[model samples]
Structures are given as structure tokens and as C-alpha cells.
Target: MRRKVRNYILIVISMVTGTVSFAQTEIENPFGLVYRDAITENLPGKVNIQPVTYTLNGIEIAANVYTPANYDPDKKFPAIVVAHPNGGVKEQVAGLYAQLLAEQGYISITADAAYQGASGGTPRNVDIPHNRIEDIHGMADFIIQYEGVDSERIGLLGICGGGGYSLKAAQSDKRFRAVATLSMFNSGVVRRNGFRNSQVNTIQERLKKASDARAQEAAGGEVIYAADNAIPTEEAELAKIPYDLYREGYIYYGNTHKHPNSTFRYTMSSLLYLMTFDASTNMNLINQPLLMMAGSKADTYYMTDEAYRKVTNAKDKELFLIESATHIQTYYVPEYVSQAMEKLNVFFGKYINSEA
Candidate 1:
């Protein structure tokens, strides 16, 4: 199974080199992304999307704000900040959930992390856990002041890696009235131990490599990074295991739902910081209402389960699972998404409506 995965990764490398040719075809302006509620020209209804930008730590952060139907600035409305996955941007699952939440009568916003996607940051795709958590705080800083957003009623929803960071952000940032995560991925754990500890023995070796990468950068050497930079069509046909999130993720991010800015790689030097962070270390600090949803069948389920167990301070918490959905499946599968959003609507509605 690992060999099959590795071979496909090689294909991604080749495709990245020839990205220009592949991009010209099916991949158009925003890149060939076809998820529901995706922002096209203009959405007609009680929900609408607007491109917005704000500065975070002196860097420009790109974001999309989804407003409820017939939005009125004179009136106040609850708000929710949606954080995208690790290899995702605000235009993918994060945007979908944001739009859905907007349709449910809350102002929703999703943003590209400072160093990833369209956001501004030097040395792209750094994937530092602290920066990610700060991005969530930055979103809160911006959205709490948005027109029509009721400061006391703001909520948060983080998907995948963003989910992990959200937990960390909520630890100290009491601004969020409620917190929720879907398909929560512990970025620190996965980075340090590999998926399910498959590479646990290589922890020190990887750390040394990351240290070397940082030193090389300090020496003014060419920036060294890591990522699956290519997407090959042929690899999709090879026999693969069912419910493999990475396999489905490659197809989703690289092919069908491809976004030019989304790639599954980060600076090799980032591991030095990533390996030392833990999203759940201060989990008890998140005293707000918490809702964590994950696919029961997802191999990444353990991360969510463990983190959920450590969240002993949340006033209320629930680990809702979509019975058969895989990790990536929760991102785009209509049925699963609908299920997750339905839960979120209730979760946010109940908590965001209640005040201190």
C-alpha cells in the first residue's frame, strides 16, 4: 500500500514540473474547483460572498466573507470564522461551510493562512503551527469588527488542520463564543510521528534534517521545501485501498477540485517548530462550548478522539461522527457535508445565542 502511495507521489512531482500545460486546460481562473456553494460570479439569495483582505502581523491576509441573506449592516448578526484544512484554501471546504452557515443566518468568513494560499508571507508554505493559530486569532480580530457582526455572538469552526489550530487558538482567545471542528487533524502529532506513528523511529532524523534546512536558509542558500508538487491522471486508476484519505485527497486537491494555490507541502525547516507543538496541551483552556465532528471510518479519527478526551474544560462538548465518511470525504461529499453543517447550525445557534 505504501509503495502504491509512493508511486503516485512521484507522479505528483512530475506533474508539478509541467503545471503550466495542465493548468491551461480544465483548470481555469480559480482553477477547476466544483464543490457546491463555491463562489462563481455572483450568488443570488440571502447568502453572498465578498472578497476581503486584512493585515495580520504586517502581512496581507486574503479572505472571503459570506453574508446572510438580505444582510443589513444597521442590524446585528452572529458571526463564525471558518478555517480551512492543511492543504486547502478558503475557497474549498472552508468556503463551503462558511456559505452554508451564512445561509443559516450567520455571517461567515474563511481566510487563507498568512504563509499559504493567497495570503502574504515570505518563504511560502511554511506551515508553522503557531502562525496557523495566530491566523485564527487574526480572523477573530478582523471579523469581530465586521459590519453587522455582533461581537458577543461570534463563533468559530475549523476544518482539518485548521481544526487543530482552532483548538489551540480558543485556548487563550476567549472571544469565540462557541468552537467547533470537523475532521479535526492534529498537525503537530502527524508531523512529528507521521500518520499513526508509521515513522516514529525517524523523529530525530527528521528533526535534524529540519535544523539543517534552517541553517541552509540562514547561509543564504536556495530555499529548500517539501511538497507533492505534481498530479498525474494515470495514478488515479491504480488499485488502491478503500477509504484512504490521502489517495482521495490527492485526487480532490490535484485533479477534480484543483486550486492553483493549494499544495500539500511545506518548508522543510518548518518541522523544527511543527514537531514541538501540541494542539491539545492546553485544551482545558477552551472553556467555551465545543463540538468536534469526524468520520467514524477516518484513519485520522484517533487524533480527534485523543484531543477530545483532553478537552476537559469545555463547558459543553460533543464528538459527533458521520458513520461512514472518510477524512477527505467530509470535505466534499454532499450528504456528509449536509450532516456536518446541520449539526453546526444547531451547535452555533444554541451557543452563539446564549450570552454571558
Candidate 2:
């Protein structure tokens, strides 16, 4: 019984870690994508997916650029740079939204963060807040220069942890004319205070662990990691998790939408930076149009709400709540996804497209 209780705790920790990394698994889709209805082969006159690689701060970044049906390179089109969720890759919900946005006639790009997924970096899954924010900026840099993309009309979409980083990226990167987030997750806040502040009492203990991990790395010791356990596969075990974000997250990332590059683990030292960062800080710097979306029923909604409330200088800032949808449901549920896409279309169309 004690062992079972410990296992349950570990599973919960794994679910809440957010950032992830692991050995690559063989993906069944031809494009190495795991999302539903992923583009198998690029064709003419339909939404086409292009595999792209570019260097960001000397690290090779892997990304996917989606073009609208009957895309014309000669004619400039508004584009969106999509930032994937924590422990997520370009091929999951990020790809789904990129594809769906493309279907709506917008060019979109989603990239794996540096040190995670197929992107190049050392000390794999070093998920510091600054690096994550830079990843969002890097995606913006690449997509803005892509053929047929209007440099002046680039928008941003970030999911989950990516949403928090995107908020930071848009604070200074004027290239993102419009900014939007779905299921925004403040990784820094969670890492420091714990999910809903559940682990607040352990802040000092966790920080000590992170400091020790960093010292070990400096001394060339085997890197310490956090939340490296595999997700529980049994229904009885999964039901033990309390939070909806985590409970459904296991089902989504572990079962239905499992991808080769997704796992919940990060260098323990990353907590040094993550624990000090806050997505809500200096949000007034985002002077561009902003649209923040989250499920009304999501346990993580507080993060989005708090961040949204801090955007004092944003032009036309709005908080959109998808009724009856939890945080994870907004990732893949057709009903919730459709609702998000509908609102995104109107938001991006209004701000990024001059013709609209």
C-alpha cells in the first residue's frame, strides 16, 4: 500500500512537470506527426506541410510550415508562429492548430523548442523560462522570413506552457502583430508555487535540489532530472491523479495523442530559472492586439486569467473562455478545438490581415 501511494505521487509529479524529453520513438505518420488527420504527403492545391530546419542561436531548430490551399508564393499571406505546449512537440496540438489555421487561409508554422523534440540542444530538456521564450522568438524569426509570408502581418499562437512563453515573446517582439494563447500555463509559477500552490511549502526544498543539480552539472556529474517516470497506463492508476489538467493529460499525451518526442522530464537545474520567472510580469509591454483563450472548467484557468488581467497596455485585449471545456480538452476535442479556431479566425483576421 505504501509503494502504491508512492507510485501515485510520482505519477502526479510526472503529469504536472509540463516540460518533457526522451529518446525518439517511431511515429506512425509519414510526416512523423501524431496528431489526427496529419498531412501524409504534400500535394498541390491543398494544405501542404513543409519540413524545415533553421539555426537559432547556433542550435538547429526543426519546424513545420503549413500553407493554405492553392497557395501562391507570389502573393503575400498573413502567417502565425505557433509555440507548442510544455512537453509537447510541433506535431501535436501545435500542428493541429497550424493545419486548422492553414485551412482558414493563413500560413502557419510550429517548431520544436530547442533542446526538446527534434531540435538541437545539450542537457536535453533544459526548460528554463528564458530559453522557452527565446524559442517562441526564434519561431517568429523563421516564419517571418518564409516565402509568401507578410513580415508586417505575423501573428502568434501558443498553447499551454508555450502560451506563457508566447506572452513573454510578444511583450517585445513587435513582429507578432497579434498574440493569442490557448490553455495558457505559467510554468514558472507552477514550478515555484506548485500547481494551484499545492507545493508551496516545499519551495525551499525544491530550490535546494535545483541548486544541487546545477552544482553537479558544473562539476561534470551525471545530470539530475525531475519527473522522469513513465505515465501510468492502467485506468485505476490514472484515476488516482486529482487535477483534470494532469488526469486528462496522461490520456492525451500517453494514450490517444502519444508522440515519439513527448515525455515529462527536464533537467532538475532548470528549476533555478523556472522558479523565478513569471509570465504575468511586465505584461504591459505587449502593446499589440491580444487574445487569450482558456477553458472555463480548466484548473489552469487561473494562470490565464491572471496573465490576461496584467496586460494593461495591450490593444484590444480579450479573455475568451470556452465553456464546459477543460484545459486538455481544448487541445484535441473537436468541439473545443472548433470553438477555439473560430475565435482565432476572427481575431487573427481582424488584426493581421489588412484585407479583413
Candidate 3:
């Protein structure tokens, strides 16, 4: 009788454990992927931007085109299509840059990636290479459809991960006349090795972790979202700078900088896709103008440098190192933003004006 009662208790415990293990908690996309913000807190005047929606490779995408507050339909203008960093929306710095350039008498638009923020997708933030690169081509299609704009004079600026995508797009698509990156991130490189090749030594361990995550995902376990949580300990003397940045700075700004929705995370399993992406494979074939900029102190410097070295057909290519600046500082800081804008203007002006 005692043995039968013990067996019964064990069965009940096992049933509960299995139920909990396979349970799926519903995850909602609260941000909706659509981003809209006035260029100024006070709001700019009479800006008639047509909020347009388009589909890229069957996925619905949304973007906003900002024109000058004093825009005249009769007068044609040059335009730019901007790409934001991974996990950022158009309301962030990307919109600011686009709007700033729009205010300077040009047309500009910014977009949301599929499945994140307000863009459409099933498994959110999956980071498939084809979708990301195709997004820019789709944006180019939208830009070309606009009336009263010089179709040949369009430019693109991508910040962080968007920067890498912008370059990748320009490699094949001839729509963008010039391209620039502000503190760019090589998503593929950063994913496989880490911000500055810090994880190159741990490639195998990372692969093991990704395989395990996939197995769990394949089973009844919930899909997990985990950012790289590299924190610098008291052992910083031996720690890599990228680890320290995450341990210290990324934590502060990530939690406080954007406010309200600051603490955002992505899937840990993305490493499987990212490790295999190499944007530089066809990078040398691009015959366009390129501007690659990074904070001299940014842990991401190597990404831009690697990309810069791979391009062979660029009519003109330049790399700028912003002094004493780190990666995130360029996002919204006045000085760095100003510097980036000035260079952007110069880069675009030189190429587009050459037609005149």
C-alpha cells in the first residue's frame, strides 16, 4: 500500500512538470512597428508627408516621407531614404536624421524592419539576411514612385546595423547614388565574433548554445529572447572592452536613454543565422560612392574597417574616425550628430551635384 501511494504521488508530479515545460506564453508585438514623430518637439510647420504603406517580398512594410515644412509641389527636390539601427524605430535617431535633411530642402523617409517595432512578420526580429537586404530595395522602390523628385539623386544613410544593410543593398541595387553609415555595426561579424571580435575564441561554445536553443525551441519550450549579456566584472584588467561596454554603458543607456521602452531584447538563437552572414562576399563589386564612419573609440571600428577594405569598385570611398566618441554617443548627441550630418551633406552633395 505504501509503495502504491508513493508511485501515485510521483505520477502527479511528473504530469505537472511536463505541462509546465510545454506551456506556451503568448508574446504580443506592442510597438506595432510603425514609428511617427515630429522633427521638433515644438513640431515643424506645414510638412505634408504622405504616410504610405508598401509590401516587400509579400511582407507589409510601413514608412513616412518627410518634406520641408514649406514644401512646394511644383518644385522638384532630391531625396534620401534612411535605415535605422537594429531594434530601433523611425521615431529614434534615424527619423531625426531624415527629418533634419528634409528640413534642409530635401525629401526623406524612414522605415521599420519586419516583425520589430511596427513592421510585419511572424517570428519577430529573426534577422534573415535576405529580408534585411530586400528591405532597402523595397525602400528604393517607394522613393522612385514619389512625384516631383529627381529619381537619380536619391541617397541612403544607415545607422548601426542599418548601415551594414545599406551597404549590402548598394552592392547590387543601383538606386542609391551615395551611401553613408553613422557608427555602423556589421551585424554578421558582431553576431559571430562579438562587437570587436571578442567572441572569436568562443565560436564553438556559442555554436553549442545556439544548437541547444534550437532543440529547446523545436521541443515544447517557449521561444526565448536573450541579448548578449556580457558584463565586465572586477576583473576588467583581463576583460575585453566590448564586454565592459555592455557591462557598464549599454546597461545605463539601454535602461534609461529612450525611456519607457528602454529595456528591449532579441532572440539568442539569431546567432545561427548571423554567424553565417558575410556582407563583404560581393562587397567589392559595388561601383558607387561610400562613406564609412565610426567612433575612434567605438568597439565596432573593426566592422567598418573590414567593410572599407573589401570594396574595390567604389568610385570614391572614405572612412572617418570621430575622436573620443563611443558607439552609442552618435545616436542623439548634438556634437556627434552635427558632425555626422555635415559629412552626410557633403557626401551626398558631391555625388548628386556631379549630375548637374
Clashes of each: 3, 0, 5
Q: Rank the candidates by TM-score, best first.
A: 2, 1, 3
Taking all chains together, the TM-score of candidate 3 against the true structure is 0.78
lDDT string, candidate 2, 229-325, tens digits:
4887676676678898888898778866777788799999999999999998999899999999999899999999899888899889999999889
Q: Which numbered prediction scores highest in TM-score against the true structure?
A: 2
lDDT of 3 by residue, 108-142 (tens): 88887766656687666666666777887888898
TM-score of each: 0.89, 0.92, 0.78
**Native-referenced Cα lDDT, model 2:** 0.88
Off by over 4 Å in 3: 1-50, 212-221, 228-256, 259-264, 353-355
TM-score of 1: 0.89
Model 1, span 63-145: residue lDDT tens: 98988886899988999999999979987789888888888889988999988999999898989998998999999999999
The best candidate in terms of lDDT: 2
* Model 3 superposed RMSD (Cα): 14.0
Candidate 1 backbone collisions, by pair: 12-230, 16-230, 46-69
lDDT of 2 at 301: 97
